[model samples]
Target: MCSSCVMLFNEKNGSILPEYTDLPTLQKGEILVKNKYTTLCGSDLHTFTGRRKEPSPIVLGHEIVGEILELAQNEPFYDLNGNILKAGDLITWTIFAATESDEFVKDKMPQKSASLFKYGHVQFTEKEKFNGGLGTHCVLKRGTGILKVPLSVDEKFAPIINCAGATAMAAHRLIDEIENKNVLILGAGVLGLIASAIAKQKKAATVTILDIDDTRLENSKSFGADNVYNSLNPIEELTAITSKFYKKGFDIVIDMSGSVEAIKTGLKFSATGAQHIWIGAVTPTENIEINPEVMIRKLLSIKGMHNYNYEDFINAVNFFEDHFTDYPFGTFIEKEFPLQETEKAFQYAIKHKPYRVLITI
Candidate 1:
């Protein structure tokens, strides 16, 4: 069988070439999936705009949802919940696959394992042309963490569960608990909004979000953000607002903006014994200085998460399935394009800067 796909020939040219390749025979423990919907994530935009570089002729999309097309013979495949997988089931998988022997797995950072194979970032070859979300099909390799999405979950929203949603779950995991805590999320993007909702659901005392975009901050209110601030405002104004609600400072601060200024301001808002989780600094940027004396006096704990682990993915799926109706997850994707218009989709996403842009296969 042949599958259609769009490949990035060069980052310098920013051209996406459409191509078709013969699907390879499924290996043991591998499953073929028909791409249903794929969303253009922030990292994908970075690569397309040459802000980040990836190998040429690579398929670049990781936030994806698909349906099982075929299952390898003689080997039983199971999802993260241990349920047996079969053809026709809707599913999504971890962005990277790691082996048990991976040293990072022992260190509890499987996403950075030595043998990690990340989907959507690999250079396309004849044998693995369908390994990314921009293609009509994808082959779930061995050791990949798979999840069977429920029929009730919208196809458009499911694609993000494995990426942004899972990363938010991982950030919260680092905080350990949220009940009765004042939580402040930096950035009102998808990750920050999702984090706000999760904090409220976990019984946080207050949930606040900060973003430069007023529109996005308004949207945050519907997603469980009790207070929203435009960080672009004057520093004194922001400080006054924070003083009004966060009298004792926030007990938990999560940075999803990757902005040095935002992180610096967030650090100042940290209450004594606060926990800070940074998930959005995946790219190179200017560093922000921190005072060791302040950290020592406040007893702040800071941690960073990259991609997510299997457990985080599972929690993300469950959270979406349980609370899909509670929030407007559908509104995130402002526009959609077909596989043939994948390039246009990226262009629209870049120009409009919508929360997400979808490519349906």
Candidate 2:
């Protein structure tokens, strides 16, 4: 594991340059995975733009699917039986930090964070704790494996399930609890499109998508949006549009773009006893005032969904496999670039005009 590894780093702001790096030595009970495909998450944008920072000279990327390249011996990676573990099996994880104790997994929240933060490179040495999917391979320490990706699924799409797809699936799962729900989602990005697909698959009475661009709205329809509206005024546009489709306000509202004004106005269009799920990770400094009385009077329910759990990941994968066309065909769009082009990939992902921009290393 001491051999040189290649990774992207932010030595300067707003740019990423590939640097030859040393592969991290395996810790006890840890396994080194040669990352195959990693997706640049929206959170990676925050870090790139200096909106967020970890320890300097760190690798960036979290959502990844990889193959185990090597395993620690002496204390073999398998169970009591001497099973020889080999590489090439596709796997996906929540990418949590490795913990020596079992107590972390016992606590749900800690376990979740640990799973998501495994690629953190707190220090820039061979102990690359902040390392993530932007490299040739990533180290997945023990106690963090979520599920192995089935060989039947496309490896390219695996990363999406962990982040964007999970957000969509989580929102849909929450709405599935209600009866004959009508979903109105803002923003026709990949998350919004995936959410609309799931909502329709769950037999939502109506799934209406709102976005300013007619192209995105058309894409939303292809992803099972029952109707599409190109409008900026959420309250007026949603009320009018949804009324024409369901003759009532939307039974649920999902804000994927994290616009405060959009959220506030969308709140008014939610039907009585409706559920509103917030999946977008808005900046912490942004603040919005909501009328508690209006929420109470309307019997509205609002929930916040972060990263999806193991079950949600499985659901998204299954959804893609079973209903690929029903969902947006180009959800995983753009192109695949080798590891060296990571900086270019990040810029392309942040720009508009595609459902998802993926890079394969």
Point to the candidate with the largest lDDT: 1
Estimate TM-scores for all models. Answer: 0.96, 0.86
Error of 1 at 98 (Å): 1.0
Cα lDDT, all candidates: 0.87, 0.69
Q: Compose the digit string of candidate 1's lDDT tens values, residues 172-259.
A: 9999678988899999999999999899889998898988999999989999998887877876765665576545688899999999
- Prediction 2 TM-score vs. true: 0.86
Minimal lDDT window, size 10, model 2:
76-85
**Which ranges in model 1 have alpha carbons more than 4 Å from their true place?**
1-3, 244-247
Question: Which structure among the candidates has the greatest TM-score?
Answer: 1
In angstroms, the error of model 2 at 278 is: 0.8
